[model samples]
Target: MRRKLTLKDVSRESGLSTFTVSRALAGAEGVSKESREAVLRVAEEMGYVPNLAAQKLRGVASSTIAVITAGTSNAYYLDMMNGIQAVAQDMDQTVVLTDIAIGGVYDIGRERQTIQRLLEGRVGGVISTLTLLPESVKRLEDWEIPIVFVDSSPPEELPYVPSVTTDNYNASLLVGAHLQSHAFQDWLLLVYPPIWSSRKERERGLRDAAAKAGATIEVVEAGNNAASASKALRDCLGRRGGRLPDILIAGNNPILLGAFQVARERNTIIPDNMAMVCFDDFPFAPYLDPPVTVLNERSEEIGRLSAHMLTEIMSAQIEARKAGKPAAPIYTNEHQLQVPVDLVVRRSCGCPDPTRSRS
Candidate 1:
């Protein structure tokens, strides 16, 4: 069997002292930049994997960061994961992916078990895309395990939990303004319940803009899945007595896809029948029959910032422990980061075709 590389091997290969190699690999400040670079390069080349278990047992921070998602199926979450993995790789930290049902049914037992397992595995920190319950947050606090939320805000009861999220309110406002400019008066917003902070903020913004534009906005509670969205849309259309709204706004990619399916089944042509817009610029948005207009939430940036914030918090805690000081939660009012979203105009919202030129 091939032998695993160790820190001693890296030290020998780089011709550096074992202490220097150790400190450099641990990202300690005492090591010179030149020495650290050389050590890291040699360690990479030699495939030197640190013994994270040993580190954890020694009461030092483990080199693993846990990234929690609602599920693994969505392309939106996949994009965010890509950004998170990139930052984790650059920092020489390992990432562990975990899932907990956040927007779905609230299973307190399952969530508690998941948290306990992560703690048992000695994960140094967490970046959660789901809004954990207040009890769950307290469990993590008890363990002193720092967590940074991505794509979702912490529950209102746990305001101290730091989060990286998009300005969904502003994004929705942009969409509302665009619709009003195009003279779309009647609006139908298909969205999940307000349990999700992003959806809540978006609904608020859209409602505000609708009021100002003298447009009537009707909101339907569609769950955050394709099947649920399709059912909700079909039910709404069936009960509307053949009166379709001027525009349809889907809250997310899955909801958009569901609505699209129902529209196709009912032979409802986009834009020509009812103009459409949605949040989340998924990869296939441009390839649809009438390419969809969307608000790009910059999900990748949210992931990157969340991971970076957790790393910073962990580093501070580590430094404090080393200095023989008590470690406290690092996230405060200043830690809440809101990334901006971009409006990607496309044909679905009555925009000009991208492939055509105007006279």
Candidate 2:
């Protein structure tokens, strides 16, 4: 029988100490980048497979589930994290939060590195809000680690992966119907770049609805931060000669806040002059001066479902291994789960709140 490749072999091939080889492959800190890369390359070339049994034995008392996300500053992500923690605490599983620098454009190199670091024997599974490259998805599949996506999904080119996301298209359709009820004609939609699937779907739904209603819709691609959103809104308003749209829709809470800043600075009136709606429902949304209308995406529910799905997949994989059977893929045609959204109406959308008496 062929001898199984070992760390000593990788150490010898990479001209590094055994300790260095082990630490590098395990993605430990303090190792030079050059040495880490060399050790990983040598191990791959020598077909050095990780000893899963030994790794489990070493840390049998503790196992972690990693949640990878971007833009921790957003309250949306924080809400989802809270839901995930609620479930994780009940199960007595440790959840580790990791952030990646994903944005409008996919960064394959950074994503791959992040996944490799998580795979170094500590994390038993992952729940990610960031969409990963196809290659990275395949790597996770080959390693037999379960991954459940929240709020985003892998590219269409890849096979179906277990994911939990909101029905954004339907949510936007509801927004469109609400706007139409007020006989609003011209519209302006401030959205993040089209790289995100959620953004694309929402835009599609709005465009389709607008086409049916004969209302003109103009889309502006604002960046994913408050500063960028403010700049984009200001520029769009300037180009229009200070004339606001009949109704303005902000893609998310951050974008809505930016628009609020600009509207206040320019002294724009609400509902009577221009109606406003936002896609996310945060705690402060109802407390705003006009109490902005918003789409409640049930972020906490998404997190709970995602964590539950990941745990189920991991449990199945464990059972399969114990029976000496190859683990089956978690995703199938039925794996796509969509949580519904609710529209909360307030003064911003020309709807009167009963709590506040009309003047």
Candidate 3:
């Protein structure tokens, strides 16, 4: 039997994205006139028809959970995702992942579109890696879909919203203390933007730590990618009379990679020329030419905890609905969690360990 025409077929034939095709077929907004016309032309030529029954059935998606994140360029993203998937799989729930940013560039419009798509699909729960807009949170709440944030906090206006994340302020203090131990007087922090809420905490802690240590610290903002980090660092160096700081602090794995790229380009030896450390630990940290020191955020643990919290709330909502009661999710003090982090020391921060170290 021949396969029936679907969104994928329309997308392939129209040379447009599946998202664009979906909006075009539904006569929804966000589809340009040119794209909509092309999609309609292709659907007519292919004898396409909407599968209303299938869509109606798909709308009963109480067993599906969506995980939303900014981007997934670093290895730690996999670790956290594995933990989330483990819990979801054990609960017999399907998982869907959506990235609001590609190539480490955050887009508010993309985030808005993603939330709408999830709602339209009748997702039962959401796990976000970063804070979302207030209205987006409200829509999910109004629908009674449980949401749990991982590696980031909910917006300030919704303090009761559940989250699982490291104590970033303390984590930065930990990093700062270690840098002080090495007596590094000048530190350069090349960090990503504040869209990832943790940036604010991390920066605050670093600022306080620098003051306490009597060390000079400078921050250069960059997009959340290695290429952006490289450019930012290169420009920062140019601004500083081409003099390297005593130590460089990268906010995350991608930024760390960019810092390395700049150092190598300048023939700058690790620790000898400048010490370095980063926020998240990755697989290659131990195996790098000079093993990198990093703050261990325990991403897998965060992911598992986040998924468990969302599932708990969702289970409660289901029970409430079954009992013909209000089906809003439950939130308690336990739901607002702050997991502590540890700094893993290595040669990259001027430690004299020539061998691979444990994290």
Candidate 4:
């Protein structure tokens, strides 16, 4: 194959230093607008690509952000990644996504090595949805790199690292209100024990809503995954005859899947037999025999907003460096962002029969 056109070629052809070419390509300052455009135009004509490894040797940031996720297999995370990629692409920035594998087995060592390598290499910043160990977070704090948390645990005291997430509490309350208005009497709020912060906030919303309406609510612990949720549902159903829950609220998509499995096995017809509402609106929710009712948590918007915050932090750091000021430390902000929860009224929650509902 012909040798790949390199950044050196662009510098030589444009009569600008390689540093100016790098900054112009990376959208960083220090190059005039005209010079930046000229460099880009020549680089495009020359088909020039920067050698990332060589760029690192020159002590330049890779203009890349690392996103560490719990797992890329999850639909929610996948959506989030798409949002992040969309924004990064618009800015002509590159991303490196590292999966923090399930069960924490593949995460610990990999994260440590990855962070060390990034510090030694060319990554500009990191945006993470993985729960960094306390010590690791502290180490990263000391490194002075711009780090933003995306839907993960936030430190109690720090007030700099920004995060964006749904208003889980309000969303749960919305679900609770939907069921209450539907005349659901006895309800079960089923969630996993090792709950994420988002789920915990949702549970609070559910409880608060139920309390307001005097709805009798019972809490059931369902382990993550469909099988465990199915088992938990069965156990709950086995308790009493007329005491069966009129509606079941599943905390997340996995739990909702389990609930569906139990409903199918028990030959339970939705709405007529029992009502159901899920937190994470699964893609197939609308196609079910009785389409699912849900509080549509906008995971993509959450990702986009979090990525925006990360971009803000990175820009600030760049500005600080240009001003010869020390970079700020990573810290969690108490600011809560509220993304509206959509109530997708569907057949599962007894789609209103217009004649009867109006009458």
Candidate achieving the largest lDDT: 3
Best by TM-score: 2
TM-score list, all predictions: 0.80, 0.86, 0.85, 0.72
Model 3 is weakest, by summed lDDT over 10 consecutive residues, at 47-56
Model 3 Cα lDDT, one tens digit per residue, 51-148 = 43346777456788999988789677888999999999999999999999787899999998887777667788999998999888976776677798
> Which stretches of model 3 miss by more than 4 angstroms?
1-25, 28-56, 354-359
Collision pairs in model 1: none
Off by over 4 Å in 2: 1-20, 23-62, 102-109, 357-359
Q: Put down candidate 4 lDDT per residue, 13-96, tens digits, no spaces.
A: 999998898899878988999999999899757645444445556444637788877545346777788888888888777888
Q: Show how many residue pairs clash in every candidate, following the order shown.
A: 0, 0, 0, 2
- Write candidate 2's Cα lDDT for 250-310 as tens digits: 9888788778888888888887778899987888888888998999999998999888888
Each prediction's RMSD to truth: 13.1, 3.9, 8.4, 12.5
lDDT of 1 by residue, 168-274 (tens): 88888998999999888899999976656777888999999999899999999976777888999889988997677899999888788889898899788889899
Q: How high is the CA lDDT of each candidate model?
A: 0.82, 0.80, 0.88, 0.71
- Report residue 98 deviation for candidate 1 (angstroms): 1.7
Regions of candidate 4 where Cα sits further than 4 Å from its true position: 1-62, 71-73, 101-122, 239-243, 329-336, 353-359
Give the better candidate number (3 or 4) by lDDT: 3
* Model 1 spans with C-alpha error above 4 angstroms: 1-61, 102-108
